[model samples]
Target chain A: MKITCPSFKYWYPRLKSGKLAANDEQLAINHLSTCEKCRKAANAIEALIEDKIQPESDVFFSARLFARLEKSKPSHSVFIFRPVFAYTLLLSLSLFLGIRLGTYFYYQSSIPSENISISEEYAIHSTISGLDVFFQDDFNE
Target chain B: MDENEKFLDKLQSGDQQAFRILVEKYQPMIQAIGIQMFERSEDNEDFIQEVFIKIYHALPNFRRKSSLSTWIYRVALNHALNLNRKNKWKKWLMNGLNLIGSNEQAVPQMPGQIEENAEQREMRRLLNKAIQRLPENQRIAFVMTRIDGLSYAEVAEVMGISEAAVDSLTQRARQNLRKHLSTYYKSL
Candidate 1:
């Protein structure tokens, strides 16, 4: 049904098999009437498609697939990818890590910087301010 | 999202009902590919089931950036080709072991084949042999474009090749098959 010669030639099997509907099939036949190249290509591969379509598989085919699914469905994937379980796991993990990190950091900071003695803070600030003044004086000089 | 995207979410999460739907939808396509790709096998149904099982396991790993059916085709074709290659190696090893003659191919006598007349059977056997002898790329191109009823563009998408490349490959595949059949007729 494609416009190109390649497409036409490739579609020969479908045409020969009459799987194409009447209208489309007629159109293909019309085109093939004038197209010796397509006809030649079709004649070459006629043997391949001449075989009857492999019979419709027995009705139990889907049943067998489902039966196999019951036996072969890997459980861990179902459990792990279960939407509710996955979301709950992620949420719980984040909460657990958040609480643990918050507590650990709080404990590590028992001597919080805000708790520095006023006198020590004043001394640290004075030293920093003095260094800034020194750097300014050097730049100016 | 589209129907397939929604269905894909379920498939990726290992939803059984969704998997069943997928099996129903794709088994026919895979079956067609199997018929076109190799000689009839006793385990043809099993091969399709194996493809489904592989698709199930591989869903998580499959990226959805492109069309899912294209990916499925690629998976089906790749699996079929790999199985064919392995079978060839096995057949060769059997031959090497002096278990079978060179001309004595493993022309499987499946149920459908049982009904074929001798002339039809001979034609099928010759076609199968010639197709199997085609270079891998040509064989894939031939199966997809010629037998599977996929357009060259569709095959290109599945194969990750340019449409021009697909066209060339298909032309070459047809030419090679023509040569193969011609040689046989010439022998007669």
Candidate 2:
């Protein structure tokens, strides 16, 4: 029996997973079956993968991170900030309403001034009754 | 409070214990990625810490648009990559040294024959080294898939990329490794 290359032998599963095509798997299997060295290489790859680990934790690190974040003032300002936000919102609405009401009343009062001035001109333009009588005598003469 | 919401509430309130819980629960995941993506650095732990810190502060603003873990993972991955870029020159120099150093000694292999019963301590070390050499995107994807064992969709969420992108990343990473090992492969 021919010894296959270990790496090619190892990639067999990956091939089965469709990550490697049939041709690639065949080549790997062929080499693995023929080469003992390749088999060992494949074994090593397998060994390596089986040993992977997650990162270790340092409790102190978290403590310090918390300390830094806590001591960091920029983020804390948001706590008191929400109320201020609400207050400002109310303030803005009140100001807007007050300005709108004032403008409405002011404009309403201003319109009558134009009517008063037109009536004053109408009074002045009325023909005097005594002037009409004098003009009547002149007419008779 | 459900786990995520409670954690978020505390995080928003600046609860230190809550932060600790978050860190403790997730540090392993973050550290695994860091080790895989970067060579040994004294600053790695700091980078991980910063990642968590950012998550803690940003949690309040985090609309539940995504899961908390996914958001945290994204933060961790981005921080890890940023650290990787900042320390690239240093990593390159160390990699050169490692190449020269590896020539003289074949690292010891784990001795065990049983499934999950074998001493994987050493093999794990080698795996970490190999993962560290992977390109940034590949390393992150590999870490998410191989180390964290997250589904492709979850990995996509953490990566802010499509699932297709994650799949491609893993494939490309494997190809890169295959290329890197071509000489060793041919020799074998």
Candidate 3:
């Protein structure tokens, strides 16, 4: 069976702090005694952990941090409904309706009046001049 | 109210004090990761400021899809990474030039900067440089664990991946770092 490369996983914390469990300490020491590669790897990781350093504090920025926090205050409205966008929409809608109505009225107004003229069966007054001719003869008789 | 909800409420109401509190809590963590990922010569302060600006504008629209910290960290990380990646080529060219000028002058080193001592500083710088050289995912995984001290679960939650993925990423990160550090220390 191939001895898989020791995952070296368990060694990280041990290597970092230079402390080891009673059982693992001997094993790590034994392995390092013969394996130069593993030894160097262990020392490097140890150095890294031992070298832990804190970053510099930005006092001025931090002092201003609270003041800066004020700047991040979320606005009440998620979406800013701009007056320009609203007015543009209103104008577009009005223009569209006006154009539609104007087109309809203009088409209607452009039609010739003769196309819808009223037809009369006869000239009523001209025909009615002697409307009682038969009735008057009957009364005299 | 939960801290996050309260913070959301304050933000919605336009309370600047609340915003400042949030930045103070998170900026150090963000700055650490930003430095790990980017060059010291870059405008990291501006980048940090922009992250806050985004959080400010985006807070109103923030849905509770993730925990507030995770969401904030995601935004911060993405912004930092994007900025770093954008300047990568410029950094590479400058790095070449700096390497050539390495012998020109006794570089003015800060006096008290040696507080950590020579060995510790070298190790940290080496570790930082190694992490920075990693692929983006590996680098974030390394920094999130080693520097930020986030738990594997927290890292997983922040990355929106399974715990198993976080484990794998972290393992890979450590494996890579171990290899790089070995090479780095060999020359010393």
Candidate 4:
């Protein structure tokens, strides 16, 4: 239906598209009345558009859909077993233990260093010095 | 509350009856979309179910920004587009299977009304396949505007595109359909 008529070509696309402007509508309708080719073309286009084959949903579609939807919702057991919840619990447990162990180790490391009195320090040095002297004397002998 | 607002309230409150009513209301529209947007073999209760399932989940987030049906169409159109993109491979697979063996079932010639309905369904299936060959936007625009008989503005609203854009799409669609459909349209 590619008529060389400028107006036909101009309006054909719009006519087929169902978007012909108000002004062009009357012109198209009048042209369509006179031009058998464009009319046949229009009829063919209409048939193609109107060849409706809408498939209906089966009777049980809703039942299957709702069943699937019910399955998709999280259950209490599923919530407890979720990876995020499991990982968070593990991380919290690890963090608590890490803090407690870190504190214990920190205190253990610092206790003697901070709490040793001058006398205790002197005693330790003197003990080391005596051992050094004893070893030195034994080596000399 | 108005009908939609009240319906939205029931939906948000997890009312099963409200959901059922909604699904029943929109089944035909979604089915019409599925027929055009999906392959004959690809469209099933599951496809519609997937769409309605999406709608079900998203209902909680519905802002009433547009009418629920408009929003549902938007969602369905998006889903169909996405699935069709992914289904390019499925088409090839189906074609391969078809080549291996066409498993068309023989229909018994029943009485008048049943046989007529079957004939109608067969015609629709072939037409759907023809429409499926169209590019995504063109196919949707063509279906929404022509087959669905939606106004260009209404289609624009559903597609979230401009009316001018819808016009261009539909024009191209009509031209393309006219070209391809020249023989088949006459035969049908």
Candidate 2 per-residue lDDT, tens place, B1-188, comes to 67767767778787767767777888767766665555454465677767876786687788888887888888888787777677677656878778544522222222232244233434444454566688777888877887645678988988789999998998776655544443244443
Query: Cα lDDT for residue B128, model 2?
Result: 46
Model 1, span A1-141: residue lDDT tens: 563454663445456545677777877787777877665555645646333344234456778877887799656767867888899999999999999899667656654567787555445445545665555444456
Q: Give the top-scoring candidate (lDDT).
A: 1
CAPRI category for model 4: incorrect
Question: Where does the lowest 10-residue lDDT sum fall in candidate 4 chain B?
Answer: B105-114
Q: In candidate 3, which residue ranges exceed 4 Å CA deviation?
A: A1-31, A34-41, A49-58, A63-141, B1-3, B41-44, B93-100, B103-114
> Which of the two candidates, 1 or 3, achieves a greater lDDT against the reference?
1
Candidate 1: segments with Cα more than 4 A from true spot: A1-58, A73-141, B101-115, B186-188
TM-score for chain A, prediction 2:
0.36
Residue range A1-141, candidate 3, lDDT tens digits: 111125354554454335567666666667777777667667767556333324444656655544555676655653425666678888999999999899778756765555543221122222245545554444446
Alpha-carbon interface RMSD of model 2?
A: 6.0
In the range B1-188, model 3's lDDT, one tens digit per residue, is 88768878897676778877777777776766666665452466677677878887788887888887898889988987888777677667877778545522221122235465555556656666676678888777766775535577887888888888877887777767766675555343
Q: Estimate each model's TM-score.
A: 0.60, 0.56, 0.58, 0.58
Which regions of candidate 4 are displaced past 4 Å? A1-46, A52-60, A78-141, B93-126, B147-149, B183-188
